[model samples]
Target: MDINMNEMIKDCLFFGMVISIFAYGFGKKLKDKWKLPIFNPLLIAILTVIAVLLALGIEYESYYASAKYLSYFLTPATVCLAIPLYQKLSLLKKNIKAILLGIFSGAMTSMGSVFLLSYLFQLSHEQYVTLLPKSITTAIAMGVSEEMGGIVTITVAVILVTGILGNMTAEITCKVFKITDPVAKGVAIGCASHSIGTTKAMEMGEVEGAMGSLAIVVAGLCTVVFISIFAQFM
Candidate 1:
């Protein structure tokens, strides 16, 4: 009976589902109770799942084998960003030049800063490659990382850390920098932080949300192009 039970748990179909659901639910509760950006549900869920896996001595491969199903919705999730963009279509058209410029600047700055820091720190080539697309969404970043001979796992981790940090600090950073324009704030957030930062942008206002939504798509494309070009030199 013990052997049978151990085998059942090892192959448990619901293990992944249970872990994700529980982590998110717990994270939501903490966020609601604390009202802190650091308690962002995604970050909290990741931590909780990691802690559980460590305590149980579960290998990451086993968990990911089942949990990879969650990635199926990533593309659709990005498409959902278009909803807010459509709502602000007129404003976007009117200010297309400025918005495009802001997104381009932000995307370049994000990748450039990472590269500069990597050089200064003398990071390994693998580390540099993994971090090049940290600001882009995970789906696109993973592809770019693969093309650049980066470790996809490290890219995903860096993306998550970048998103959480950007989401937590963007408001304060904007205030200190005196960035009063909603469009600028939205573009900065989405270009540097992706979906997680867009959550904060949505809370700021409809206009910001719309701008951030647009920035996510543009930044993703720009990162892909940048990586493709850079890969030639590598």
Candidate 2:
């Protein structure tokens, strides 16, 4: 019976895609109805998918086999972010120095905080490296984790949590910190949260979206270089 079920799931090539879309759509509906940050569509969708998979005894590998196709669009989607950035090119160029400095500072702060916590907690070297790239996008973070001999799976999980937290708290944090500058808001969100957080940044405004998109690229590059140097210490 189990073998038959597994085979049935495996043979249904669209199963994962269908489930993912339906889950996200349901999540969106809930968010629209609630208009609450806690009703975050992505978070709800993730939880819903996990629940369904567990309830059905579906292996993640089978689900990923079909769902992986969706990831093919990730790069293009990221590139599409440049559209807003292009619109705000004048603003970006004018504040290029400040923007670069902000992103660099944010990246350093993220890594430094992780290092300090890891030291305080006495986490293993592998664990420390796994978390070092937690604030960047999945693609870059995974590569950095692997290069630094960290657990890529853990790094991905950390990245997701980091992004979600950033997404959920960005506006509140800005208000509390009195960060009124749109560019600063964007840079902070993108640098700390990567692509997932950028979604929230986009909703904030076009200028915020543009700066957040720019931050993703610049911070990712900075992390790549910084991680390489930092690994020498480990």
Best by lDDT: 2
Q: For residues 91-151, could you state the per-residue lDDT of candidate 2 as single tens digits?
A: 7788889998999999899888888888899888898998899898887787679889999
lDDT of each: 0.81, 0.84
Return the clash pairs for model 2, or none: none
Residue-wise lDDT of candidate 1 within 1-234, one digit each (tens)?
234433444677778778898899999999999987788787799889989888777777677666777766777876675676576677778888988888888788877788788889888777788888999988789878888888998898888888878888989999999999998998889898898888899999987887777788789988787765543432
Error of 2 at 51 (Å): 1.2
Model 2: per-residue Cα lDDT at residue 53: 86
Off by over 4 Å in 2: 1-3, 72-88
Per-residue error at 127 for model 2, in Å? 1.7
For model 1, the local distance difference test gives 0.81
Question: What are the RMSD figures for all models against the true structure?
Answer: 2.4, 2.7
| TM-score: model 2 vs. ground truth | 0.84
Maximum-TM-score candidate:
1
